[model samples]
Target: MSRDTIRADLCIIGAGAAGLVTSAGAAMLNRKVVLFEAREMGGDCLNFGCVPSKAILSAAHAAHTVRAAAKLGVNAGEPKIDFAAVMDHVRKAIADIEPNDSQDRFEGLGVRVIREWAHFTAPDTVESDSVTVKAKRFVIASGTRARIPSIPGLDTLPYLTNETIWQLDALPRHLFILGAGPIGCELGQAFARLGSDVTLVEAGTALGAFEPDHVAVLREALAADGVRLIEGTGVERFSGEAGAITAHLAGGETINASHVLVAAGREPVTDTLGLEAAGIEADARGIVCDDRLRTANRRVYAAGDIAGKGALTHLAGWHGSVILRNLYFGVPTRQSSNPIPACVYTSPGLAQIGLTEAKAREQYGGKVSVTSWPFHDNDRAIAEGDTAGGVKLVLGKGGKLLGVHVAGARSDDIAALAAITMAKGGTVRDLTGPVLAYPTRGEAIKRAAGKHFEPVVFGPFAKAWAGLLSALH
Candidate 1:
């Protein structure tokens, strides 16, 4: 038997956001491009992760708002949730976004789309069932999947992961989650609001590596949503018979749920691809790429979750653009870990950019100052009845805006401003001097910065300093 060969200027593996965007850009530059994928075109984020989850979160938020009407002086009855309808909404969201990332769209971009798994057959060649792709440069945008832990008997239990959770037909009467990270917290709250009894268990304290204040806010919000959170505890054992799952805890307790959701974490999906043939180094985490998003083998590059540089879809897209610039235009661009923003899609979403307070204090020493202002005090928050959270700004020794953490309505939107400021190395004065609109959550940004003016406003030397300046004039 003889093998067939196809040649392209660039060969991209995985048709997710990173791979597809890179292909589109590269092809537009008149570089011959070939793309391979073993799964759906839009990858995990479009098909399983962000889109479906956010759709569910939106529906859950609406339901929660209706239930809270009594407290807002409007007494509405209990919401009758149709789980099927919720799933329908999720599917519709996927459908609406699918066309943008469909195979037809990529083909329209003058890139060859191959719906097959690719394996490296040589240092400069990859082989799939139908074609042998030869290219000067390659990109590994292969994404990640839910990482199910090795809890005893967990495999035997009827469980769900982000990949399959959206496919569920009926809502679980009770949902037991095994982690307290972003995914666990977001899904736990959403389902609980939809009338499911949700129990979330975390081995460490709340949302382990996050800031203490953030942990407190999330804990309080989850508690308010009628979700039972078991922190500082873990599952000792798990067993399943028929459809029910019983998880025995290390603390001599047990939790029974109609379904178990293992949102523990995610691991990169890079094993099946023949990386060793290309001499590329990777681990359980992800492909080890250099500052320029280049693999150890210079001919290959990586982007997105697979690169392990940043797990965000936006970051991945940015990395893809950087790779294109370096490979095509001969421009050198590197990845930066600073000023990246992430959000948890809860009610009054939690959005964080740059360093946390503890991190700032440790890295920059005692010269850092922290200031916070509550959303409850903001006119917009008060008017909207969502005065549950606030914003905090961390500044360096000389008023450099080190970070901004917001946990209130429109925090997600506010994060863009924070990212741009931090990336541009702006100071507190810049944010404070801007005249933000009245009755807006974004005013919290300016207000938090204004707190730095407190000493100038009422310091012990205020009168003396004013008199001295007046005399000098």
Candidate 2:
């Protein structure tokens, strides 16, 4: 069969978050656009990773709330979880948001949506089974997939990755998850809370990227949620089948579980993109790109996880804007100039941005000041009886807000307040100026900032002035 050749102003591979934004925005700019997808729309985020994980967490949160209601003098004794219903909710959540990223929607925007895997045949030409596309520019937004580690006998049995876990018809009696990073931790807690016996085995420290103190709080919360955590060790191998499985750890201990999942990490989807043919540099971390998100081939750009940047849906959209400005506005946008926030949704969620206290102190030494406030001191947390976590503020010599970490209810949202201030080059003082609403978790940010300035604001000079004013009176 003869292949149809189409030409366009822009050709985007992978109809994920980054590609969707680039396609939609370029279409609005009246540029001829062609988009390709190997699988579902909305990428792994809507179809697998973020959306479904959060939906399950939302279901688990309800179960937790019912269990905790007794503390508030309401007896919501032992909630019964309808596992199928919970999965239904997860599907509905995906379905509800599906149309926004649907192929029909992009086609409506005048984007030529190709439902085929695209590979580069030439520097400027991409071809699939039925058609070939030649465009002035190309944007690669093909995201990542769960990275499955090679362990002995792992492939001998059926296992679940983030991509396939949503098909779970019934909850695992005892779910064995490898890796305790954000995804592993979140899924472990969610399943345990929803009445599944869950165990998480990690080769490294759990949530090793976050500050030790903040990670401690999250670890404790995971334990309270009934997640059995095995850290600093790895699964030696796996044996048995889908329903009956055994995990042998490095230390010679074996765990029998009903199901196994590999949440170890994500691998960028680039093996099929024909990067070598196009001279684009890439590796295990994804495609190597500059701060402007340009690949070795100037004619091509990559965004989202595929850009070698860490996975964050918000950041992917930002990357699209950067490309737009560079391509059309000649604005010379840089992706790393602004600090990005990383958040984990594990019970009292964890959110962190910029430098950690240890990093700031190592860099600035005496120039750094650390201020922390526990949620126990915050009336809102006390009222709600969830006073497990707190907030930490890191500052530099000139009172510059270096970083902020929060582990409490709405901690991610609370970090937004500090993010805005930091993004504008504002100091901790900027965080303190606003009169945050009472009985809210966000007060923690302002409270921590106020603590950072307490001594200077109410010290001997102010006291001496107060006394001198009294004498004058």
The candidate maximizing TM-score is 2
lDDT of 2 by residue, 1-473 (tens): 77999999999998888999999999999999999997998998899988999999999999999999999999989999999999999999999999999999999999999999999988899999999999999999999988889999899988998988899999889999999999999999999999999999999899887888988888888888888898999888899887999999998999999999899988898889998888888988999999999998988999998988789988888888889989977788898867789999988889999889888888988899899899999999999999988999999977898889999788989899988888899998888899888988888888888998889889999889989999999
lDDT of 1 by residue, 347-436 (tens): 757888878898999999988999988887899989888787888888897898777888877788976777777777888888877677
Off by over 4 Å in 1: 457-473
Candidates in order, TM-scores: namely 0.96, 0.98
Residue-level lDDT for 82 in candidate 2: 98
Residue 10 lDDT in candidate 2: 97
